[model samples]
Target: MSNRFKNLIVPVLAVVLGMLVGTIIMLVTGYDAGAAFSALFEGAFGDIYYTGETIRQVTPYILAGLAVGFAFKTGLFNIGVEGQLIVGWLASVWVGVAFDLPKIIHLPLAVLAAAAAGALWAFIPGFLKARFRVHEVIVTIMLNYVALHLSNYLIRTVLSEKSDRTPNIHDTASLKSPFLEGLTDYSRLHWGIVIALICVFIMWFILQKTTLGYELKAVGFNQHASEYAGMNVRKNIILSMVISGAFAGLAGAMEGLGTFGYAPVRGGFTGVGFDGIAVALLGGSAPIGIVLAALLFGSLKVGALNMPLEAGVPNELVDIIIALIVFFVGASYMIRIFIERLSKKKGVK
Candidate 1:
């Protein structure tokens, strides 16, 4: 079989095994797994509103997956995606609310503010890693906490008028679309989905069709060799992180301008950043794969909400299934070996 076909087998098996395990668990716990799954499917796709909402949920996941996957592809573990996303959301909302410009200018400015803020936030760790030999993971983890508290402080002091959230962004800066809303029963779907799709294509093109991409991937494969081959290793490292952060920032912009229309003081992580790790892994860091993985995750998340209402099953059961799927993906090596064994058996016949 072709390598691409073989590559597809791992995730397919992982998802199947995850669902099978989830069913077994439900049965063992005395719940009707069939009804639960049926509800899930219905919730995800039965109605136009639900379908639109699922797509809305998917929008951020796509950008977040790109953020994490791009970094991983370039040999960086950007654990700071949450921190970067938080700052991006804050920056985007700040610009959106602070400005009074034409829609053509204001919207792009807010979105660019988000991307710039995320890139700036990520640059710190990237610089440290490149210059001081610090681990990006450790720095990024610490930055996540710093971002959480700092954003809250800024909200209470700088961005808010004694309120916990910023004011709603001007309509000119908003991504919310009345036509899309009407089409989907007033779902929060917006133009960010188009931007996310564009970004996916950009990433694919950058990595597959550009000299810069070749250098970046080369550095990722072997930093010393890439340096020896006359590539600016440190520069590529920082650039990769910055680009990854830009995508993460756009994810935040989706929430601020498209979903909520304002930036609220978050008491904790948004969870989207962390979930990106799973999405990236399952997608094998490929752009198209990331989109597909995001859709699956988005479906599960939106669908899980109906579990209790329709089937009397705890929604957290879906979380378990998601975790199992990630676990199986993490065990892709084993799955590949199993496939190879089966191939060998067939050959022997």
Candidate 2:
């Protein structure tokens, strides 16, 4: 099979295997697997409301997945998406609530702040990696903790309102759901989905059509070789991280400006950033693949909330299924072998 065909086949098979495993687990737990699955489907796609919620949930995942996937394409492991996301959230919210401008100006300004903050947060690790040979994975991991604490402190002490959250943002800064009135009750789905799609297209264009993308990929494949070939390995490395961070920041801002309307005190880590790793893996780190993967995860998350209420299944079951999918995708060689063996058994010669 062609490489493209294999890439598509692997993720599809992984998902099928994950569902089969999930079904077995459900049966073992004494639940009606069919009923549970039915409920899950209904909750995820049964009605317009559910579908909108799934899209809303997936919007951030798309951005976060892009952040990780983009870095992976350039051969970098960016564990610091969590930190970059937090900083982006804080910066956007800070601008959104602090300013009193018109909606057009305020919203754009907040978005810009988010991107800049994320880029700055990512820059530190990139600099260390390019200049001092410090491993980006380690630096990014450490920065995640720093960002969490710093963001918590800022919300509680520096920007806190009477409540634990900042004030509701200016009207102009809010991303109202245009389809909400026409659809199910009050879905949070907004224009961010469009923004995410645009980003996906941009990522594809950059990676497949640009010189900078070629340089970054070269550096990722082999920095020494790229350098020998006259590519600026260090520059590409640093630029990749910055671009990755910018995407992460947009993910965080999507939550703040698009959904919440204000920055709440993040009591602990939000799983969005970490979840991006799974998304990137499941999507095979391809732009189109990442979008689909994010949508699937988003549907699962929204549907899981309804499982207990409608199917008497634990919400944690969804997490288990997700973990299984990620595991299968990561160890796809086994699946590939199985496919080869099956193909041989069905020989038509």
Predicted model with the maximum lDDT: 1
lDDT (C-alpha) at residue 89 in model 2: 88
Q: Write the per-residue lDDT of candidate 2 for residues 227-305, one digit (tens) a residue.
A: 9999988889899999999999999889888888777777778899999999999999999899999999999999888
Candidate 1: segments with Cα more than 4 A from true spot: none
TM-score, predicted candidate 1 vs. hidden true structure: 0.99
- Per-residue C-alpha lDDT of model 1 across residues 1-349, encoded as one tens digit per residue: 5679778989989999999999999999999999999999888887999999999999999999999999999999998888888999999999999989999999999999999999999999999999998999999999999988999999889988779899999999999999999999998899999999999999999999999999989999999999999999999999999999999999999999999999898779999999999999989899999999999999999999999999999999999999999999999999998999899899999
Model 2: lDDT equals 0.89
Residue pairs with backbone overlap in model 2:
103-172
Q: What are the runs in model 2 whose C-alpha is more than 4 Å off?
A: 161-163, 178-181, 341-349
Query: TM-scores of all models?
Result: 0.99, 0.96
lDDT of each: 0.94, 0.89
